[model samples]
Target: MSSPTTYHLVRPHVVTEIPTLDEHQQQVVDHAGGPLLVLAGPGTGKTTTLVEAIVRRIDDGAPPTRCWR
Candidate 1:
């Protein structure tokens, strides 16, 4: 008789820190709903703002998969 193999699944630890948002950035992050358009020049924190907004949505019980889409 052959013995069954055992497998262990482990999730890696990840450290994510939210950066401080400026006044305009905060407004965008706090937007309730509707089509929002962001226009800014270079060196602005557009990517950061987007990421934090998505994080906030996920924190508010939104599905991670939906957030990505």
Candidate 2:
């Protein structure tokens, strides 16, 4: 028998200009997209991040109608 010695994690979000993420919130913001479902308890900034992502997409030249926001 053996015991695992280590754990590995990859911080999901790569913030382009935003200075910092509160480590905890980084993963939440990162997993905000794609053809998947996200569900969790309250007090998470899920809605806020979604809005931020949409705004970022638009800022980065994605046309209004082209953005999935």
Candidate 3:
């Protein structure tokens, strides 16, 4: 009889600070329903802001599909 080898996957724990969104970004994220448009110049945290909004919706018990059309 031969013994089998086992491997365990491990992920590193990362600590990151949540970005502090400005008033403009906060307004966009707070609007949960209806159609909304976000336009801004470069380095305006567009991706981060949108991602945080989606996360907020999910955390609020909204279905993933409901976040989109």
Q: Highest TM-score, which number? A: 1
lDDT of 2 by residue, 1-69 (tens): 798799898889866664354555455445545774556567666666666666667887779788763
lDDT of 1 by residue, 1-69 (tens): 898999988988989776989999999989877889999988799999999899888998889988643
lDDT of 2 at 44: 68
Each prediction's whole-model lDDT (CA)? 0.88, 0.62, 0.86
Q: Each candidate's TM vs. the true structure?
A: 0.70, 0.44, 0.68
Q: Name the regions of candidate 1 deviating beyond 4 angstroms.
A: 1-16
Task: Pick the winner on TM-score between candidates 1 and 2.
Answer: 1
| Order of the predicted models by lDDT, top scorer first | 1, 3, 2
Off by over 4 Å in 2: 1-33
Clashes of each: 0, 0, 0
Estimate candidate 1's alpha-carbon lDDT, on a 0 to 1 scale. 0.88
Model 2, global lDDT: 0.62
Give lDDT tens digits, candidate 3, residues 1-69: 898999988988989888899999899889857888888999889988998898888888889888653
User: What's the C-alpha lDDT at position 30 in model 2?
Assistant: 53
Clashing pairs in 2: none
TM-score of 1: 0.70
